[model samples]
Each structure stands twice: as structure tokens, then as C-alpha cells.
Target: MDIATLYNANINNITTAKNAFDVLATTFGKATEAWQHEIADRLTAEHWTGTTATSAGTQIKNLGSELQAAHQELSFVSKALADAAEGFAAAQAHLISALDDAKNAKLNVAPDGRLTWDNESTSPNFAGTDAEATAKEISKRITAALNEADHADQAIEQRLSHLAYNASSGTGLDAATVKQDQAAVAARDQVPATGTDPDGVKRWWDGLTEAQQQRFILNHPDQVGNLDGVPAIARDQANRINLQRSKQDLQLQLDHLGPEPAHTVKAGRGSVENADYSAWRTKHDDLQEKLHSINDIESRLAGDKLKFRDNTPAFLLGFDTKGKGRAIVSVNNPDTADNVVTFVPGTTSRFGTASGDVDKADEMARAAKQADSTKTTATIAWVGYDAPQSILPEAAYESWAQNAEKDLARFQIGLRSTHEGTPSHNVLMGHSYGSTTVGYTMRDHNLPVDDVVLVGSPGVGVDHAKDLNIDPSHVYVARGGDDIGIAIAAGTLNFGLDPTWDSFGAKHLPAGNSDHNHYWVKDSPSVRAFGEVAAGTWRL
Candidate 1:
């Protein structure tokens, strides 16, 4: 396809198909769920009994499962159409802009994207001295647009080819649809060689239609929920869908396990003799822990949007259920706030054990409000990285901080890129080894925060405040008199120089003999002082 042909591509037809498939997917899923509820209502353990009842229940479940599988297939196709439409739209816009530039330069662009001098003679258009160079630039852009459109077309053709695929399955048409989708999935693997810059991500997001964005969020929530540079509200909504879906999946897995055995037989050195029992036990335990972690997150959300001390809604900016898990949540929209403070919790604050950290973020917002009620403040609990799981084994390694650098930088950049109003005063704080993550990220990336706060730090991975990315005067440190482990770690382990040390030349906050874990205690001087800093009213 050439520039003119691609520019006039029928994206509207793809969008119409996408909308139709989207509705079909939603109907299938809702119908399955409704049927499940009806089955549960009818199949009472006390009343429904017998071989016939058991057979009926099993068949009923298979029907629901088939519908659910069909929903997945339809959703994938819908998203494929949405992706194709957006890709074509972007290419069309690119071509249009290039054409406009060519027209302004008084160049005649052909249908095949060839450019010539508009004066009907080989003459320069007065852009640069060389007319050939200007023509080449316009021609290059047109070529790029055409190439982009071709790539989109190739992907869509493969994704839509599932319509003709057949699979040999006893479960019939739904089974065939599910099987075909697997090949379609493999076909659309265009690959991600390098990540887009956060600014570029914002530009792409800005170019998307609302319907396109919604399809992305609904069909690919895992990607959209964690993506930087997207709006917080959209991220929150996507994450909530992800959270509920995960919980439901875990619950289903658990229910499928049925009841546990009365006794377990052990063999050899201590392993279970029964393979079935061992498998069931292992699966049950893993699922239970994951579910528990999810429950903790749900509690933090407080049945709806995470409510702070005030009625302000907190947004779940990101979440994951894998391994130790991760969560990034903010207690108010940073886009609308006058001040934004992001608190990175240190050791032992994994998703399952993050309630305390979330509470601290909440307290930080309240403290900021107390300092300057006139200004709106948003405090975020950023558990975006897998912090050192324990002090003895994990905290001692700088590797954890090293691994988190890119994600942390992107997250901070996202906050800056997505802000809607006047630039807000931004503060980044880290406690204990989290200070290590902040320090590494700062050293590596030009994080957009205005100030840095290191509290109860082992070290900031810098020998002096001047070594940090920000001005040395913008660095602030607060250390509790009773923060013994951190003090010892800073003095001996050599993560770097202690920020609170006078030689380091960083500003100070009053710690006043507090402990390592007491910084965010309600109404405490420490939380209030941190809040004041966030509110842009703190003094040395």
C-alpha cells in the first residue's frame, strides 16, 4: 500500500466490526455469569442430591465454561480490530501531516508519494538551500507512513484469519473458536524491540479515540493498567477489572479442588506418598496465598476507590498478583493536585503486607492538608518494585535497586507527563532500602521531582548530596535517633554516605528519637513534617 491509498483506508469499517464483536463478547460473558448464578441458586447441597443431579451440575458447568471461552475468543478479535483501526488512523495522520508540509513548501506530491517542485521547473522551495534534501525529507515521511500502514494490514489479516480455521473437538463450535484464537494470537506477535518513551506513550494515547482506548483497557487490562503516561482514572478502572478477574479466577481454582482428604500418607524422607494429595495440597496453598494478597489489596480499596481520611478517592495506579506482588496507589488525582508526594516503602512492604504502607500514604495526604489546607495534595504509595523481601538476605543487595531503576523512572516521568494544570511541587521519599531504590533511580534518570526525601536510610547510593541528580540543596534527610539498624548499615555496609550526616550537606527534618517504623504515625511530628515538605512549606 502507498501513502494515498493508506490515508484513505476504511478504518470506519474495522471500527464497526470492533463494536459488534465487543458487544458479542460482553453478552457471552454476562450470560455465562448469570447462568452460573442461576445454577448455584438451584443446586443446593441440602436439597439437590442423587446421580442425576450430579450429572446435571457437571453438564451445566461445562456449558458456562464453553461460553466463557467463547467470550475470550470474541474479546481478542474485538481488540485486534480496535488495534488495526488505531494503527491505520495513526498512519493516515502521519501521511496527512507530511502532505501538509509538502504543500506548504510548494511541492507537488503525487498519488504514489513522489514529490516535485511546484513551479513546473526544478527549483528550490526556499526551505533549505538544497531542494533535493527537502523533497527527500517529505518523501521519507510518506514512505514511513506507508510502511506503518502495511505492517498494520499484515497483522490484521492474520488476526482475522481465525474466521476460517477449524479444530477437531468434541465441544463443537466454541472449542473450534478457542483453538483458532491460539493461532491468531501467534500471528499478531509483531514484537516489542524497544519500549516507547513516556512522552511518546502520551502522544500515542492522545491520538487514540475513546472507544479505542476503552477496548485496550477492557481487553488488555494487564498491559493498560500498568502502562505509564496513561491517565490515572483509566489506569484505575483497568486495574479494578484486573483485580476482580484475578480474584474470580483464583476462587474458581480453589472451588475446583473440592474437599481435602481425611489423612495424608508420607513416604521416604518426608514427601507425600499420594501424588494426588501432594498436587492438590501444593496448588491449594499457592492459590490461597495469592488470594490472601488480593484480599489485602481489596481491603485497601475499601469496597470502592480507596478512600482517604477525607472523602477523596484514591486511585490504584498499578497492581500485580505474581510472586510477592506489586501495587502503586495514590490518595487523590495527581493531575489536579497542587502538590504531589510519592512515598516508596522500604523493606517488607510487598503487596500482601502493604496495608501499613498504604495507611502511611493516606496519613501523608492528611498531614499535607494540615500544613496547607489551601493546596490540594496527592500522596502516592509506590510499591512498583519488588523491594528487598527481608533485611538479612535481600536488603543488603543493591541489585534490587538496580533492577527497579527503569520502572521507577518511567513512573515518575508519567506523573509529570500526565499532569493537567500548573506544574505541581513534587516530592519523592524513600525509607530504609527504598531510599536505595530512589537513590539509584535518581542517579540514572532525570526524575522530574522537585525534592528528594531519604528517611531511615541505609544509604542513598551516593557519597554526598551533591552526587544526586538534583541540586544538593534540594536533598533532605530525616533519621530517627532510634533507627539503629539503618544507622549501623549506613556506617558499615557502605550503600553510600548517610544523607543526614552534616558532611553530606543535605537539609534536615526533625526525627526526635522516633523509631524506624513510626514516621507515618497519625498526628506525629514526623508525618506532619514530611507533609509540610510535600506542601512546599517546609523549612530547614
Candidate 2:
């Protein structure tokens, strides 16, 4: 733990140990990966009959997952060993180099790390070229190196304790979670805080090599999953892992709570509180809600056959259980898309309704194709903010809209920052009160979208279209026949001018016949017009 002990430490043995474990982990991973693929389809009902086979098949499938889980644990240890060895080697190198400098300078470094004079030179009274200052600098570097090595050692110890806990605990390792949570601790330290602005974050991300990025994504998925400036591919991979781990964690909690929850029992001969029952009920309800939110996300990720319709894979950009809940689902990879339309839903939207929002995204993508079939497109259902959950008081206030302005603008810019090729024609389409949110985003932040489409909007935070800082010609609006009440809310509710009005300077797009939610009804003119905007072919 001290300078002398570290100075004499032999890290070659550590390297040898790390190399051996790396090989073992790789070999084991390959074997389990093979096992994972083996039983996935081969052990189904068709391969056998009745009870024993069905039970074996289920357990075998689980065994495959557990094998992968064990492989991940092995990998975590291997990675930790490698980190420890590297930390020690770097620290030792610094110390040795410093010692050599001291020796060359005719200065002596004491066993206790103090500077001393040589027997011939000055004898416990010498410094470096700059006297005391040089000695201090050398001492500082020496201490820093030792501290760094100590940190690495501590990290290994912590991970070892965690590994032990996983083994002794009845709950086994989850296949999808073990690697990122345990193996990626080192990478996580290198990441910028989640609070960093999108553009700054993008600079750091783009500076890294592709292999480094991939490693970060594999090991530190939680850190990058919801990051605005990260590319869609990385975000998707990270968020998918996040989704798996979230489900596993929540399911584990639910299992631990057990089936029978205590209910309220009478107290004395009078009405009284059942604190335990109340607490249990509250926790149960909250967990169930979170589970529902996660399930909604799972449903939307059902791949090509469901919402995606075509063979395009779903890209989950973000998901969170904050506020009412938040989810951002993209129908395709936005990084490579020629046109990207992001839909921000209105009041009462939550994670429970995530599936419907993604359905709308799919419908938007389909409608965009109707405008121009050749254009690569992505439609995103972005409920990335804490939307107002009530109609009476919450929706009447602009707090929700104001709070979302920064993130929405950063997200739009992040799309431009990380996109693969030519600039995408990005459209910000807001439905109902979502328009209010978009309006704030544009007016305050000068959100750089190619077009702004307002559907069934009450107002968009600005009185004049020009105030949004976009080309007035690019501003468009639509309404539903049943949304008259929403129109009355414009201006009077302090939400700004009605965008659908001729004086607002935004051209009117066709409104749907039915209701506010029918704007993207299949084959509707309203949907097609919105699609035209996404396709960059819409004209006044």
C-alpha cells in the first residue's frame, strides 16, 4: 500500500495472469455463444413431446442464457485483471523514470519518498536543478502514481466482492446485464457526464476511434444509451441492453415481493392506518407501473412484423421511468436517413402509451414513402420530456413546454452532428400541445429544423411565424374538425398566435376530418401533406 511496496511490485506476473484469463474468457464466451445458439431453436416442441421434454427445453433455454451470463462474469474478471496490471505498470514506470531523473540530477530519493543528498553530493540537504521545487515536483508525481495504482487495486477488490455476492445470492446473473454493469466500470469513468451539452458530447464521441466507441457501447451502455450526440447505431445498441437489464431488474424485484401482499386490517374498534400494508401497496403499484412502461417498450420493439411493417429494424434512442415516463423510439436509423421526422406527442402521453406513439411513427414513415419512395427515412416518436399529464391545470401552463426547449433543440442538433452522410431534411412535427413545446424550442433555441409542422395545435409559443427563426415559407399548420376548443385556446391561453390562421404566415395544410388523433390516418390527405413536408417537397 506504500511507496516501497509498490516500487518493488512485479507487474509481469500480473500481465501473465491477465493474458491467461483473457484467453479463458474468450474461449468460454465462444463456447457459450455456441450453446446459446444451439438450444435457441433446436429444443423447441417439434424436437420432442410432452412434460419432461418441455421442461428440459425450458431449462435448457435458460441454461443457455446462464452460460452466457457466466461467460460475462469470467470476462469481467479478466478485464479487471488487465486494468489492474496496466495501472500498476504505468505507475511503476512513472516512479522508475522519476528515480532515474533524480539519480541523474545527483539527488537521492529516500525509501520514505523524501529527497535526500547523496553521501558525496550534499547529504540529506540537496534539491534538484531548481532546488526544493524540483524535489517537490518529483515527489508529487511519485505520490500521484501510487494513488493511481491504489485506485486500480481498489476497483478490483470492489468487483471481486460483487462477484462473490452474485455467486452466494439466490438470484443468478442476468445474461444481458453482467457485462455492462461489471466489465465496463473503467470505460464509464472516461465518459462525460450525462449533463454535458449535446454538441460538446458529440465532439468527445467523434474523437474516439470506432473500436473504442464499440467497446464503450458494449460495456457502458447505460452511459451512452440516452446521450443526445451519440449516433443512432450506438444509442440503439446501448438502449437495447438498457432495456434488457431494466426488465431483468424489475422482474427480479417483483419476484421478490411475492404473490400475496398484505392488505389493510382494522385497528382497535376505530378507523386507523395500516402502515405496512399501505407501504407495500404503494411500492407494488409503482413497480407494476414501471413494468407496464417497460412492457410497452418491448411491444414496440417487436421488429419488422409489427410497427416497422417493412424489414427495417427499430432503433430505440432513449427510455426512462422519470416523471410520467419517457420514451424515444425511432422507426429506422436516423444517422443514415435522408429525411427524419420527429413527432412530439401532446398532453397525457406517457411510457404506457409508447406503443401507440411508435405506431404513429411507423405510420409517418409509411406516409413519407407515399411522398417519395426512394428517400431514406426515419420517423421518431419522441416523448423525451416530462409532458403535462393533466388537462385542467398542467396543460394550461407553459412550464412543460419551457422545460423541454433545451433538450429538444439539442436532440435536433445532435441528429445533424452524428448523421452519416449528407445533411438530413429534418422536420419537427408537434401534435396538439406538443406544438406549444416545439414553438418554445424554436423561438428560444432557434432549433434548426428544415420544417415545422403543427397539427391540432393550440399555439406555438410565438405570435409571428418569423419569430421561430426558421424560414417563414417552411412553417406549416393543420387542424382536426373536432379540435375547435384547442383553437380557442390559442392566444387567450397565452400560448401565442394560432398557427393555422392566415395572418400567422404559415400555410395551412389539410386537416383531418375526424379528430385530433386522426391526423395520420392511413391514406388521408393530412397524412400525405405531412409526409410531403418530411420529404422536403412541400410547397406553399
How many clashes (backbone N, Cα, C below 3 Å) per candidate? Answer: 0, 1
Residue 69, model 1: lDDT of 72
What TM-scores do the predictions have? 0.62, 0.62
Highest lDDT against the true fold, candidate: 1
- Deviating ranges (above 4 Å) for candidate 2: 1-189, 257-286, 302-308
Residue-wise C-alpha lDDT for candidate 1, range 163-238, written one tens digit per residue: 4342234332476557666654543332111245667666556545444566678887887788888889888989
Q: What is the lDDT of residue 141 in candidate 1?
A: 90
The whole-model C-alpha lDDT of candidate 2 against the native structure comes to 0.78
TM-score of 1: 0.62
